[model samples]
Target: MSLDYLVAQPVLEAERFILRPVRKSDTGLISHYASDERVARMTTSIAHPLPPGAVDAFVARAMAEDRSEDVWVIDGTREGGAELKGIIGLKRMDRNQSEVGYWVAPPFWNTGLASDALQLLVGSNPLKNDTMFASVFQDNPASARVLTHCGFKYLGDAESFSVARDATVPTWTYSRKL
Candidate 1:
């Protein structure tokens, strides 16, 4: 990947938080939340007992000019909330499509932050994608609801490898036409 073909990530705003590109300063907070077993086990990535410097590497990739995915920190400092409430991203795919992924800090769970962030990202559609896709482990229905609430329809049941769980977990796939 090269800078010439990179698409600049845009800052998106919401009533409670703003979605902005990840920065070096976010490493600490991201590490703190992602380190939680409750948070790590739900996603396909983010290994449990996070390896040394994992967050640093993740942040570096996010800031890379030629990265395939666009990641944003769900910042809430504007509303006097936590500066890093969570993280969200869209991984580009062929055919003007992308895969959406996100996770909220355990402390912020049930606070509607995830839902707001998802809605904001979809509404912005920064990648100008024709469609978007997402999948959630069957055990995490909360995430599935967040997607459905934002207009993603259930596509089918599937499985994905979870780095944290170290197993192939059942997942529910969904997609929304833009």
Candidate 2:
């Protein structure tokens, strides 16, 4: 997509959740869910025992006009779902590609929220991306399932530093041609 087209981020809707841009009011819930060690350790960015103001800073980045990534909160209020079940985002890469990432609050695990959210985002192709990439820590089979269910083919194995784990973790890389 062209720069002009990419500038305006859109709110995505699924049957059970609404993928909307982050708002100032969401900081508390973001901090609440992300602060959990279980939630933070599974991903690359969120740190365990989340430092003060981390959510605020993340919110600011997500809301930035020139941000390279487009983030959406998995808001389920419309369907009487949890206000914040998780978050999903796409970081723009070269050649009409984007990297997808997401995490689900523990309360919503095994409830198909993650899978639904993944399908919603992949189906929308909100960034108008020609390709989408993703990676999941090898230990997180559910995440890998979500990606494969959405048609992402395994690319290779790699390692990424986890801020929460404080160690480099093995990851399985996957990609999909949109």
Query: Top model by lDDT, which number?
Result: 1
The lDDT for every candidate, in the order shown, is: 0.94, 0.91
Candidate 2: 10-residue stretch with minimal lDDT: 1-10
Positional deviation of 173 in candidate 2, in angstroms? 0.2
Would you give me the overall lDDT of model 2?
Answer: 0.91
TM-score of 1: 0.96
Model 1 regions more than 4 Å off: 1-7
Candidate 2 per-residue lDDT over residues 53-134, each given as its tens digit: 8999999898888889999999999988888899999999999999999999999999988888888898999889999999
Clashing pairs in 2: none
Report the lDDT of model 1 for residue 102. 98
- Top candidate on TM-score is 1
Q: TM-score for all predictions?
A: 0.96, 0.95
